[model samples]
Target chain A: MTGSEVKKLFYMENKKGVLGKLKDGLLKTRRNLTERIEGVFGGRIDAQALEDMEEILITSDLGVKASKEIIGIIERTDPVNLRETLKGEIFNILKKGEASLLTNGHKPAVIMVVGVNGNGKTTTIGKLAKRFKDEGKEVLLVAGDTFRAAAIEQLSVWGERVGVKVVKHKSGADPGAVVFDAIQSEKAKGADVVIVDTAGRLHTKAPLMEELKKIKRVMDKELPGAPHEVLLVIDASTGQNAIEQARIFHEAIGVTGIVLTKLDGTAKGGIIIAIIRELEIPVKMIGIGEKIDDLRDFNAEEFTEALFE
Target chain B: MFEGLTNKLEGIFRKLRGRGILKEEDVLSALKEIRLALLEADVNFKVVKDFVERIKGRAIGQEILQSLTPGQQVIKVVHEELTSLMGESYKKTHLSPNPPTVLMLVGLQGSGKTTTAGKLANLFKKEGRQPLLVAADTQRPAAIEQLSLLSSQIGVNFYGTKDGDNPIRVCEDATHKAKREGFEPVIIDTAGRLHIDDALMDELKMVREKILPHEILLVADAMTGQDAVNIAQRFDEALNLTGIILTKMDGDARGGAAISMMAVTGKPIKLIGVGEKLDLLEPFHPNRMASRILGMGDVLSIIEKAEASIEKEEALRLEKKLGTDSFTLEDFRGQLKQMKKMGPLSQILDLIPGLGKFRSEINIDDRELIKVEAIIDSMTKKERGNYAIINGNRRKRIALGSGTMVTDVNRVLKQFIQVKKMMKAFSRRPMGGKGGLNIAREVMKWQ
Candidate 1:
């Protein structure tokens, strides 16, 4: 078989596996949300069942405002139609926020991954680098998280693991200079996509947010309208604070999308439901497991089906 | 976002206060508000239900009837319950009688095990105990290196092997090395994994068996939501965790997850990681966390409350006014109005400890403040802009116009110039991690 044919076969097989993995990855979340909702669900939603449904939705981390609104819309549906209506509501919200990661056209498409401490910013960058590299494109990783100890080493290790080059400076070096240098490098000129990994910072820290905004300004200075994608990597376990993180990060540095990570755990990333319903920021990708291949594009229809089915 | 639980309760109580007498419907309404605040704070619905029940049982009997402010009484009841439920007494983690006490740290992926391990070692080292940082986290690449580098930075010994596969073996060898080297405590930093990962869980159990550590701390994120209970229960059930260490406490998260895990797993939270710096780890104080959670009496919470009360735009405007040399009487008048809205001065002093001296020196009479504002209002725009332009005749005219003595007008003008000089100095200093009003509040607290 030719390389394209082999690629086709791999994609065909991986497509099924990807959906299954997405389902399996989100199995904990599905069990956490759908099964409980289904258990409390019935025709002619009783007061007790409605309250239980609301409780489950709130506890699932759907957030109070979103849960209240979702339950309000679902409770009005006819009996026996509740399940489908709930599914429809979620699908509509997820659908509005669904967008595939597309960095094909922009020269040196820069994707900057940012989040609070230990939200998988570096790992997500590594996975993205591998994904882009697998698509037969030159991928370059930038170690912009210069604060944490051995953060540059961690990115370089990912670079080696994925067979890519990493542009970095010493630890404690200014991240703006690092980003500027990375974009100016010859490797970046030839690379199709340059992924910049920022230091994990809580959005509440004004100085840290200012630093991120400064680095973002640097990106624009070097390449006008650069950092084509500012993906906020939020841990799935994060609750209501995800909204705060999303808002502050978006307000300060401008997040184009969210990469919800650690979904293989029980967390449903229900904060995304809150994020899209409130902020209108689409979730473009999700990190399911530790393996690099565990990363996948978010599918609204299939993800909704995973919970229902 | 996490300013106060009292605000939510107060809002509901305000609604209740509008009605003269409390009725059954009002009680139910109050419970609903408490329920929603806890839920939004990320408290588990089950725990919240129980807590609301307890509040109903405690707050309704004699408390509400005798209380002057029903809202304050209800907030007090909830605050007391939260503190008690979270375990009020603060105690350090009990060190084992034997030397080389092993501390095994575990948690979910990206939960800050490596950095927390380094912090634990640093904390123990600072306490005059030689602790060894064992890099048993072989899963994530460069994680061992990260810990090793931290060990170097902190001047602590580290143990790890290149074999990298068997975490149990690495932990075993590290303990033996710690024993030989006379390091008082061996902190085993385990790789973060999902609690449901049976294989990895089993591996962690084996490492636990091998080390037979005195403390198995589940390093959890303070920002964890409702699932904190489930995760904590699983780790507590699986490894029989001795204590819990909550990381990232410096964030704006209300840290309700601390309460959830404490209520469910019944494990003492040993330490809290306040910042990324290794030295930022401190012993967990439940009463303080309870206050921190409610945004009640804690110093940080009060400062944050002040920040929340002072609008960001107003702060920026104040910063701009201070930036230029033209901090006028108009800005000083604005500051007075802002400080009035910061809540009762006496109550603020009572809430913040170590301010007893300030309490005596700063006599904040609202009427006097109003008179001062009137004095400022009586000044002309040019005189307000350049207080230096104000003469004794203008001061006498201002006092007569504002219904105050000339001495009062002189005092107001003198205070405004001093405040201008102080604010200018603050604005000149670099703002490292604080905003405009926050820096102001910090200086006020110190003052």
Candidate 2:
């Protein structure tokens, strides 16, 4: 068949897989928050009922501020359309902050991924490399997280799996030098996109935060206006600390967007609303599973719909 | 990023203290703040609700109403209740009387099970117990290598099957080897899936049945809020865990999971992994954790009691605190409070009238001491010394500042004069007689 027909066929198969993973990853969140709200609707909408709904939402890792805001909307609106009112309000928060990766137009668009340890910085890089490669781009993986012992090897494993080239140094080498080398390699090979993975360092660690700044400076020196997107990967299960982490990292390095990972592992995926409302940073992707295909470009409507379904 | 939960709770109580009496409304308002603080710290909502309710029940009762320091009494109740909620006492992992105690570490992916397994092996090795690291987590990419690397770093014996061996078979074979090799603690690090699936659970169940580990320790990431509690509960339902090992204590987690995990799962947290280092493992203590959460500063009283019972090196540290000029107003406040807790002074004085020679060593009643503290608290650093410089105007300002009358300030000044005279006399006591030597030795007991 022709190119457009092949693209349509792939989209047909990929869309089904994407929705399936979304539903699976958000199943616990739906059961814990949305389903509980559905049960509340079967009764009178009173102060007690509204408090119960508020508890469910807040306990789902949605901060007290956002949960109360939604509860206020539910209480003020007509009771007959409570679910729509709540969903619409949540959709508004996420819809306004919607963003996608800026990998187009720029040559070898550099994206820097940063977050605290175990928030899946390395794994998400692996998935991003795979996705960009699947889109027929020349992708080069840069192992910029030189602090962690297995981080280099971890990204290299993904590089091998996705059939992409991973530029790395020794475990304790300066991460800026590694990024410099990767950018040099990308220039020589005329790569389409370069995704860099930084070590999983806490925002509280000043030296590590300084290291991230140095790496960004090195990227700019090599290719001015490089690192087009600085993505912060946050674990879905993290509570209010996720906001603090995002705020500090954004202040330190000006994070462009977020990648919420380990969605399937938590019932508190409601932290998504908290992050969006508090940070105003767009969530570019959601990690639904451990597999490469589990990471999907975020759709605000699909995410809100999956919560109810 | 991480401060004492007690500081926030105490901020609420500081407001209540201004009210003079503990009313039900005051208790309710303070409980509301406590609930939010606990929730923000990632404590389970159910646990936070129950914890606040319990504190409110005790706080609004006659105990707080009748107590002289009602606000402090409420805080004490919170500290006590928090300690009980997190498991009343410290619990050590039970070692089997028989040799080769097998421990199977299981959790979701990225929960630090493999790293904790290495830490546990290193700890047992430091205790002079032989430990074998069993690499049964053959699923995740490089999981086996990660565990083996940790083993080599700590120089512990490791057991692993060749490529493509089922985890259950690997665990079984590893245990067999551990027993034959005389390893006292066999740590079986099992595989973890990104999410809990029946396939993964069934495989873990198979490993559990085959190995029949003496202790099934759940290694959970402490930063996971309510999910850690749910994971602990689910794992407990499946594996019947012996204890929990909370990893990433070094991180700036609100510590909600560490507080709620034991309550939700009804399992003790045997150990905590503070950092990536193998030697950063610490035994979990509920009382000290409660004190730290309340901003009570690690509850040094627990260490003091431990020193009293064990007579360890920590007693020397306490002695230094007492013997040095580092004893400031803050230390005096603590000492005054501790002296009131020591009981009636008349009986002690009747037993030993010679206590007057060693006045600093004596535990005197502090009911009159609180007023002295208020007066001293109002004094500027310069005025705390050179009492002669405190003229009439300064005395009036000091009285107004401390909310005491000028007459009360004068009475405190007069008491300080008498105490100074007595201190001069006691300082001149000769160190030759048996009584003097006995007094010096009695002072050393507390020092």
Candidate 3:
């Protein structure tokens, strides 16, 4: 089957399952951000209630700018049906920013993943590899994060678990060279997709970012117009730093998509809206749990309802 | 990004200073700015609400201070309130008088529990106490090896099974070994689940029961924002945690967890993991952290840095000089050279109170310090003892010798006279003797 056909089949089989996972994943956030808003709405709709709702959104890790925008939408809409107003506003923001993972409908789609340390970049890569592989596409894992102590080993472990081939060099090897070799192998094996994992360096580190630029350049040099998707993985629990990270990474290497992780663990998952609204980057996927299948495609309506429900 | 809170507060304070007298509307506007800062920092909304309310109650009906702007007065209140909210002072991890004080670490996965375990062991070893590391996190792949690697790096004793041993069994065996080996603290690193699952809590509960640890520290990632609060609450309910080790503090975390954890969980944050290195562990001081977050500069930390860098007799002599009218330009230049020994002049300036807001604007170039040193070097002993002796030709000669203009010498002499007067005035006050003097008192208390 073609990739689109496979995706359609998967969606058909697991639409309800995906929503159920999202609901379960967002339980903590709902309690933290929405339940308080619900309590405020249950009372008389006054200016105090409006300010309380605004406070809830801001405390939920939504950026000051996005939260104010949301509050503005709520104020313009009906206050009696606060839940509906919030849902509509959040849905609009998320839907406007929604984007699907681009495959390019070509052989060997190149997806480069980057993020700060401990944001689950390698795990996301593993999950994506398994996902495409399950859809009957050839997947190749590139262990481009050679600077971290156990990063290569971690990627290799995930590769082994997923039963896909991992292209890696020894620890401390040149990451650009690793990506170059991985792309060579992808073409040699005729892989349908190659997911490259870069080192999780802080965005403030200039020399390391220079290294990332070099890797991107190498990928394009080896295969013209490669690195088809520069996916930035952000931890959902991140506060304002999420926006800053998205801006810097996007500016430095051109982040094409976002993979938000650790949604199940934090109420700060409101950062999703902040990132989407502020950066205008599509959140292609959201990881709710540590399991490989815990990831689900970003759905604006589903996410908005999940928050309120 | 992480500095956003400090920057915002500074802007608010600047706006507040722009207005002359203390007004209720000004305080309200300032409180609103503070509310946004706290919320943006990921502080719990309710906590921020209560914090702002408390500050508002104090700020709104208070007499204005003649010594400070209304903005500075509000900032002082906030600094004190934040300090108390975070817990007043540094809390040392309670060590049992008996040997083999057990410390079990528990938290959700990726919060740096394993690395923090290694750091804690390294900290204990540095204190000349024997610490045995127990790798009880058998569930995660390579976790045991990770701990063992850290143990080897820190040269601490390690206890783990090559084969898959249950966490409870491993912890029990490690406790036994610690007792037999007379290790002062047995630090057990436990497994972490992605979420709070029954199986994971059961496993942690079993380990806690088997070891009966003296301290259960939740190694939370400071970058996790509000999640850290929930994680600490859950772990505290389940394990009755003694303290917290907030890891990844050096990251661009808004530090809401650091601000809220103690208030929410009622557990003092004992240590913080500032970096990935084993030696990067630091004692958590609420006052210092609060001051740092407020951009008021952590004067206590700077004083500690000074105490570490300068000899006791030298500091005492400087203090005596300040108390007497004997603080001359020679001693001023000597003090500048001594301060330079601690670190870069810019960094040193960051630790001074009231300087953080203008830290970026004021450029205290290290080269400028050298010029000041050169100018002071060119002065005669009599002229150095009393700046009044420096006539116009003497100033011109000193400026020429230092490769600077006569105006440079005049500026230095003027600033020296001002600093001497300020020190003379500060030395006599007992209470509320300026922000800098209070910091000096805190350092003396620490000593």
Candidate 4:
């Protein structure tokens, strides 16, 4: 779909505001990339133009492997139509990862948020909680990050800010127990959605991965197909190692979607395009800033527009 | 993190091995691989271009040496370029001559400023100085609480105002408190902010103006991508940072941010966070990291840590065996016994391939080491020297003798093979200390 078509069809929440926010949000990345390829796609067939175009995309954090693939695909097309061909290739891949979270599934549908340390997991949860609460759903945030100091407190502050009740325990309590307890009581509490805030861990830590698996197992036992969404929150600034994070975490815990956090900054979460192209994990959301209102659903057209802007 | 880059470089060099001289085509293809590897490592595009250009200049037709393989010659040039680009000298946080040295930590959001504050305090506290951790991060929710909790964990003094709405006021209050409490070094943990955020940048400038920090450290994530250089430059322009503390170095990020930041800002990384624990902070060694990026393990860091637990002679012997590729299962067993004294085998074993992929938890620490040791002990002398001879039947027998599962024996054998190859990778020559460049350079003189 074209950028305007998607903007018109989708974005019922903030048709005007979303685009404005995204424009400003991606200003740095836009300036960096848009300026690099300003004269690239306009010329007749020139190998220099294509090489520079590939470099622009790679420099914007699209990754070497993905950039090479896209460049190769674009090379087959006539140079005069490079922009349309490139956009088409990106839109095709972006479309694969554009689904939103399963918001209307089972009542009190569970959303498990996970990532390596300091990738804005708690902040993303706060924003998600605000969104769900704004939608008039009874949101219950479970503090499953018992590892980091004040992690529970961080989630609690988000809950307080968003006007939702949080299920939590003291730091160092068993996270699986917390998840089990949250799941068991959600129906009685009349909660319409449960967002799990898990401890940030590198996927390379096998035991931590096992713990996450245990948490999933406990959830499934308590409610089959619980944790309907396992969202991996990747910092936009994260480099090539994000591939490993996506691979291992998906292998260990079966990640259903990815939330690209801190996209408001200059670090193009362009890696998500790479992740989706390689791993097929849907891009459910993009966290624009630290504020509760800074999050937006992953719109393929909007994301590609921002990247190619 | 660097395994991919090293493997590619090694493969490219291996293709050119046994050649007495570097052909023009060989160097061009090798330069292409090096360019891709650097880009994949997330080094800044501009920096990568300059780097590849330099390598091309140094590795072209006239640069070949008769005494070395084409691979060795290219590697020597590449290693020198990496080390020079990263700044060859090591550095630490600049402590003032006067007491109450102030260090202001600043960076982008979630760049680990608060955690690095704790680590810096902990490191200095271990040195017998009472370092105060100041939680001036008033923006993020519960950031102050996190720093306060870290201070308590580190058993060092902490200074934070619960209702200090302004971070400048908070730093002002914290510096006074540090002076009053005899906290020798005041670590002001400023809130992480986007470099483009003018208001927050101004706030940091105000905090610096008020506290007059002896050192302004930009705590950055080693996993940061191309924006790492831009982020560092902006912060350096705003705050004129004294150094950097790179966190999450333990993770499998190629840590290209380290190279990018140092190259752009010309700032030395003072410390690195290698693990989650506060005590996992260690001095930054540029040469070791440079060597590491080139696929040479951080042999000096490992040898130095080992020296603390084992006798100097034993440490030297272990180093010799590794350099000579004579490290056997028996030597592995002996090292395990001594490594037990150095703390968790997994942490020290990050330099070891395969076994380090997943540094097991504490519960799996010494127990796994003991099982592997027993499996090795159950092996015959010849089997110890040659791990390949341990067949399925032998693995079952070793498992029975060690009173463990056969899978345990299999894992030990796998680890032995990996460790064997890992040692061979480090065996080009003695890796630690100076004169490391001379072997290739020294050989070049014979040309």
> Fraction of true inter-chain Cα contacts (below 8 Å) kept per model?
0.66, 0.38, 0.33, 0.67
User: What is the descending lDDT order?
Assistant: 1, 4, 3, 2
For the predicted complex of model 2, DockQ is 0.23
TM-score of each: 0.80, 0.78, 0.79, 0.84
Chain A alone, model 4, TM-score? 0.91
Worst 10 residues of 3 chain B by lDDT: B438-447
Which stretches of candidate 4 lie above 4 Å from their native place?
A1-16, A186-189, B65-68, B309-347, B352-367, B370-447
Which should have the higher lDDT, number 2 or number 3?
3
Which digits, one per residue and each the tens of the lDDT, describe model 4 over residues A1-309?
232432232223454498888777777777777676667866765778877977787777889999999998887888777877887898899999989788676876889998999898888898888888888898999999999988898889778868899998889999999998888883425988899999989876677888999999998898888888999999999988898899999999899999898887888777887899999999998887655678888899987788677
In terms of DockQ, the best-performing candidate is 4
lDDT of 2 by residue, B208-308 (tens): 88878999988887778667677878888888988888887765666788778888888888887766667767788888777667655543432332233
Q: What is the C-alpha RMSD of each candidate to the true structure, in Å?
A: 11.1, 13.3, 9.3, 8.5
lDDT for each residue of candidate 1 in A109-183, tens digit (9 for 90 to 100): 989889999899898888888898898999999999898988898899889978999999999999999999999
Residue A297 displacement (Å), model 3 = 1.0
What pairs collide in candidate 1?
Answer: none
Cα-based lDDT for every prediction = 0.80, 0.74, 0.77, 0.79
Q: Give the Å shift of residue A220 in candidate 4.
A: 0.3
Instruction: Assess each model's interface with DockQ, reporting 2 decimals per model.
Output: 0.38, 0.23, 0.21, 0.40
Candidate maximizing lDDT:
1
User: Which 10-residue window of candidate 1 chain A scores lowest in summed lDDT?
Assistant: A1-10
lDDT of 4 at A26: 79
Whole-structure CA lDDT of model 4: 0.79
How far residue B175's Cα lies from its native spot in candidate 1, in Å, is 1.7
